[model samples]
Target: MTETLRKKYRWDRIGLVLGGLAIFSFGLAAWVAPEEEQVGSVLEHPNNAELPESIPALRVQEIQTEKAKEPELDEVVLPCSCNRNVLKLAKNPYSDHRRAARNLPNSFFVKDSNELNAGKRNGKLVEVKDGRGFHISALSHSHAVLLPEVKALLEDLGNDFADLLVGTPSEGTRIRVTSLTRTVKQQNRLGRRNYNAIDEASTHSYGASFDIAFTDRPDNAADCSAPTRAIQQVLSQYQKSKRILVIPELSCMHVTLRP
Candidate 1:
């Protein structure tokens, strides 16, 4: 009986040890298995999943696009008769003639009254009627028959010249008659004959010509104070641009069309 009891006790001890080992193994498996599963699940879903298309950097690219679309400014086209370096005066009708006269060469001066009258008959002189005169002619020359565009331009030039005389700015710069085809007498260097000569087949013949004489003083009437330097600057520019012809002389300029 003693031997049996001892054997039973030994067997009990062995069973306890086996049970403890089984419990430990189960606990380890529960903790480690869950950690492995969590790692696998994280690996399946990447951080970038469900994202939309690639976004562009608008700050840099948009500015570049806008800059490319900007319009260029118009270039200054100088008249051809003057040197290319000269700057063009603004197309202000009131000041254009005065500015033009100031820019014209000294060679262009009005001859004596008789010479001018002779030139008027020979198709060499262009007589531009003032607004008042032009209005009268307009009644006779139907608007449909006349070249409106040319006429408008001449009228604009005339108005501009008148404005210059009155010390106003040219607001409406246009041409009325492009080429009137009149005649005038030109005096020679010696000032002897007043023959019907084409002083200049100028736009002036079309009533587009204007003369700029300087004022002597605030109230003085006879003397002139035309600025030669300023006029030359203008003529130089026109010559370069091929807009008009400039003849430089003592006190006046003979300005006319380029051709």
Candidate 2:
């Protein structure tokens, strides 16, 4: 072959090889680039811009963002059960009628009149005849009986009465017991005169309930209500402590022992 023709052929081969290498380098660059930066084999884009959404990926991101933005919920609490009145009057929360007698302690119920009468015969009861610290009601329920424990309760209440009367003109005044133990028959008879008589669960039959007289004067005299307020305060303290339940009636405080 001639020298010039051979040189031209060599140069042509060299150009072909260089062009192939350039094409290969561009393809490799596109393969190694991030998916967001590569649109197609020939196209490239800046990574700083947001890409168009794929349907599945977009839904997943939206769900994640919603979960993060949602508020967390809090736990809830319940209320107490005792919430009704007994005497058709405004309920004394101290003596909530919702209480079930089925769960009451054994000492709280007399079971039947026979058991109460047995208590009287067994000296488990004591006569609360009028004496130094208290007075009995003038009503037909004059002969009142109480459990020994309850009699002791009255004696302890005398101290509360004294504390109430402290620095007052009525200091050392005796408290009056308005009602005491009643037979089932007595309770049934009294039910006619009193609407609060519940023979089945009556603590009076058990010798565990008692009534004290109170009067509120609109005049608001100092120490005039000390007896009434003091007794009520003491009874309320006991009621809050869960030792007894007190019903603040129109004219008296009816108390029942926890036992």
Candidate 3:
């Protein structure tokens, strides 16, 4: 009887152990099955359903563009022989001669009447005398051959009037000439012959070459008016004819056969 009771007790313990194991196994399956389903859903759908529909997806793109700008060029202007101020003086006939004269230095000398007549008659020597007096000391003679042509042109301009005056600097004006003459000889000796120096062979070496200056009249108001007008007219005519070249800065006129 003791042995049989012992065997029955062993069977009862085994049965109880099996029942506890079954309950534990059921709890594990319930927890693990839900988690496995959630993992599968995450793998299938990367975007979460909880995210707002209004939120847009991010985008990237490249754009080409150009900046606005002003035009580089508008119009081209033609070069002219006469400038604006020269045109203005040409139009204003009664401009002030004293003002113009005052602008000139004291060194300027006029060609004398006698020399002027001789140049016109002989058509050879290019000499200009002092405007203050008809003295030979104030005269300058050039060796350029074109002196005759320059003189002829000046004569044509009718600059030989009693009132009109021709003047030159005591030294000389800066200009270019393309001739061989005695004037170039003296200038070369004095080291005054620069690249721009008028060649003795140049037309400017002729006494016919001239620069204008105001008459030394006490009454600046009266004498300057008519003479300035007349001079301007003559200059304008010469410019139009291309007989004389005027450099405004030097206030000197260069006359020649060449343009």
Provide the RMSD of all predictions against the true structure, rounded to 1 decimal: 23.1, 21.1, 23.8
Candidate No. with top TM-score: 2
Report how far residue 216 has shifted in candidate 3, in Å: 4.8
lDDT tens digits, residues 123-163, model 3? Answer: 45443333221111122443333254543454454433223
Candidate 2 colliding pairs: 108-259
lDDT of 1: 0.37
- Name model 1 segments beyond 4 Å from true: 1-226
Better TM-score candidate (1, 3): 3
Off by over 4 Å in 2: 1-117, 131-133, 215-223
Lowest summed-lDDT stretch of 10 residues in model 3? Answer: 58-67
**TM-score against native, each model:** 0.25, 0.52, 0.33
Could you tally the backbone clashes for each prediction? 60, 1, 14
Query: Lowest lDDT 10-mer window, candidate 1?
Result: 139-148
Per-residue lDDT, model 1, residue 119, is 41
Residues 1-259 of candidate 2: C-alpha lDDT, one tens digit per residue: 5889999988998998999889898887776675535455235333223345455579898998878666432111111111122122233443343152223333444545676667778786677776544667675642377777777777677667667766665555566778887777777777766667743456676677788763222222243445555665666676667766666665566766655
